[model samples]
Target chain A: MLRIENLNVSIDSKEILKNFNLSVDEGEVHVIMGPNGVGKSTLSKVLIGDKNYKVNNGNIYYYDENIKDLTIDERSRKGIFIAYQHPQEIEGVNNIDFLKTALMARLDKPINLYEFAKSIEKLSNDLKLKENMLYRNINAGFSGGEKKKNEILQMRLLKPNLVILDEIDSGLDVDSLKIVCENTLEYLKENPKTSVVIITHYPRILEYIKPDYVHIMKNGKIVETGDYSLSLKIEKEGFENIGTNIIEDNK
Target chain B: MNIINIVNNKISNSKINNKIKLKENKNICIDIIDNTKLYIEIDGINIKSNIDINIDENVNSRIFVFSNSIDSKININVNQNKNSNLILNSFYKNDDVKENTIINLNGYNSNIEYNYSCIGKTNKSLRINHYFSKTNSIVKNRSVSNNDEIEFEIIEYVPKGSIDCNLSQSSKIINLKENKCKIKPILLIDEKEVNASHSSVISPINDSDLLYLMSRGIDEHNSINLLVNGFLVNNLNLNEEEKHILFEKYIFRR
Candidate 1:
């Protein structure tokens, strides 16, 4: 459902992603594994049209529509959602209120308040988030795990067609990770046509949610694509050993 | 709650359980006692007024002051007696407004919490003095300026003998336009035993915050409106009705 061809991204006139390319089909799960500063998070942000990231070359196609010129909100309304690694803490905006506004904006219609409230209650319970958190400010004073869960909560509420989980496994405890993974799996089961792109450094989360293809990203481009065994090999031998031959071959 | 309308020099005889409406040019003094809640509405054209409020000993009171005026100058003074408690919430939206407010902790063990929110061209100065031991004061101010300039100067003072007093001041201004907005928080503490802190910030609405909001499918205009409303209306001790009225009259009017 999403395709990127020879994408070159930069920030502050310094290139970060060089000739990056990837494609994800509908109902497929793609996991990108890489070391720190390999443009994993940058790719996530660029996909959502982050203003700081300048697209120096190439284009992004979502269902064959060029989205390079679309604003962040436009892309979001077109069913692209990114769960930030570090979710922002908005001090005054209520969590539920923000979700409601976002849901309304995405659907471009009025919502039933009773059904909205009921859905929020059910989702919060499923995520193990406290009911009172809905009444509090968006991610303000929340624990790291709570913030991650909150992002997942918004993902469920918005129900985007393309989901980019940027380090969703970071800062989560064992139980919280299990809950998040289970909820994600449930979402995939319910919506068989939604596509997901999981970005991470380790294979800990892969144990819960298997990927259709695991791609090793190095220097802002995919160096190797393999099955789930590739993640296990990296875990055992490390990223340095797995992608050395590819880099030497390119050199 | 009684609704008392004050216009010109007319003063309501009812002191407690009242929502007082002040209009036009007027000077009024009120003494609150026996645990009460007061909602003071200030509205007029070119209003100039002085308001004085005194809280009696051991009394706990809450006051909400909402003002929607133009070209106004208002001065409010408050005094708290022994072991009294007071919570004051003030909101102002005016074209050109100047306000000076002073509060005194006159008796031991008294405490006060002051919250202020405003919009438009305003120059507001506030001072709270701890004249007795074991007193406490907390002041928080939030303002938004679109085109016109806004400035807030808040001061907290404690004398040498006012031991064990606590004081804090926080002021922030969200400048929506390329206009000059300033926040000054000053703490004058002569007592070594007192706890005092102050902080101030003035800037445009955060771009990252806006991006985060807009990434959730909210348009730029609606996202900004939501943030502005949250900054001004949230955390205030206002009922739903009062918040709705403020949003419709002042926030949405922009």
Candidate 2:
């Protein structure tokens, strides 16, 4: 479980996340949908301990332990995973080398290269990725959808307890979206104790992975909370049309 | 040629210029043509041999210089004939040294490949000059410095009529500690159609690289080791034993 209580975050002295709170329990999927520039990506970046974002106040807890001062690697080792919306392109670093290092970092034993290659081959085949991608540099010259699939591949290899996916469905065509969603949902089902926070703009992915709770965020705050129907309403109308509905429901 | 073991050497103040000629294609050791040039020292030897090499037309040769001396001062002069190829590969771990090498490509379409790698905290001054005596000649060099105080001055001179020649230099300096490393590649080309390029980089292991490596559970120290190894040992055509020797000597010893 991960908890964020009244987290006030700012970047470059400009306020971003103000009085924000969210809790992800075991065996649950939470989706946050909002308009652009509403701190959806900021939440994910802060959780991953990106130094560009400064914490003005508040705390974050991972499994009841305060992770406010933990480094990004420490947070990663603690099983808090974030699939970046825009994954980093690191040249001259081989893909298999990176994955093996990550797996080694998470596990106490040395990962067998044969087994690792087999798993990567299976994942590559299932995602329909290029066969040579494993030997290529990380995300170097990959298409946007290919980069997204690479992120999902990392998620599967890392197998963290709590996963935060930021806009995983963006840049994905229809077929790639289905492959990504199915792979993610299958992983989530196999590991029912894992929790996830999916931050996205489109509701297309929600059609596959049902959310236990849907939150509408605007101006650095969640304005509405309901079942997946909130996302459906927002899809039918727009963000502006849901404000009156939130007021009506709250009253 | 077999490279000998290292010995604690002393500096010597003697100079010997030995001339060698190649009419037919052959591989030759440095001491075979110029074995009488000896610098006297107590514990170990200091090599101060000046070599002048002249190659005939269509001759191909390779020269290997493996120095285990702790102090050395060497100078080399080269003249190549038409369609000839010269390969010079030198590996050294010296204490302090001043070395100069000059090549004159006097024949059309001649080629030279000069590879060098050095280890130790020595003060090194190296100057390499390539003079294009004819059209369509080429000279290329690759060198790596292992945290030494080295000032390299490389110059490629092409005359106004020397056309279609190629000159390139690639040098890398891996610094684990703060050190003085300077590289100046001066291309003095009078020809309009000649190809000349130079690239030199002096950087420690990049922080982003370290972070990316450490993100995979390689701690900072081990990450640095991996990156330094990748930078220094990769891209070379060394055998496994040579690579192990290089890893144990230049990269890991520092």
Best by lDDT: 1
Global lDDT of model 1: 0.87
DockQ of each: 0.72, 0.23
lDDT tens digits, residue span A195-247, model 1: 99999998999999999999888888888888899999999988886665553
**What overall lDDT goes with each candidate model?**
0.87, 0.69
Q: How does model 1 score on DockQ? A: 0.72
Q: List model 2 lDDT by residue over A123-153, tens digit each.
A: 8988888988887767889999999999888
TM-score computed on alpha carbons, candidate 1? 0.92
Candidate 2 docks with a DockQ of 0.23
Error of 2 at B159 (Å): 3.1
Q: Candidate 1 has which clashing residue pairs, if any?
A: none
- The i-RMS of every model, in angstroms, reads 0.6, 2.7
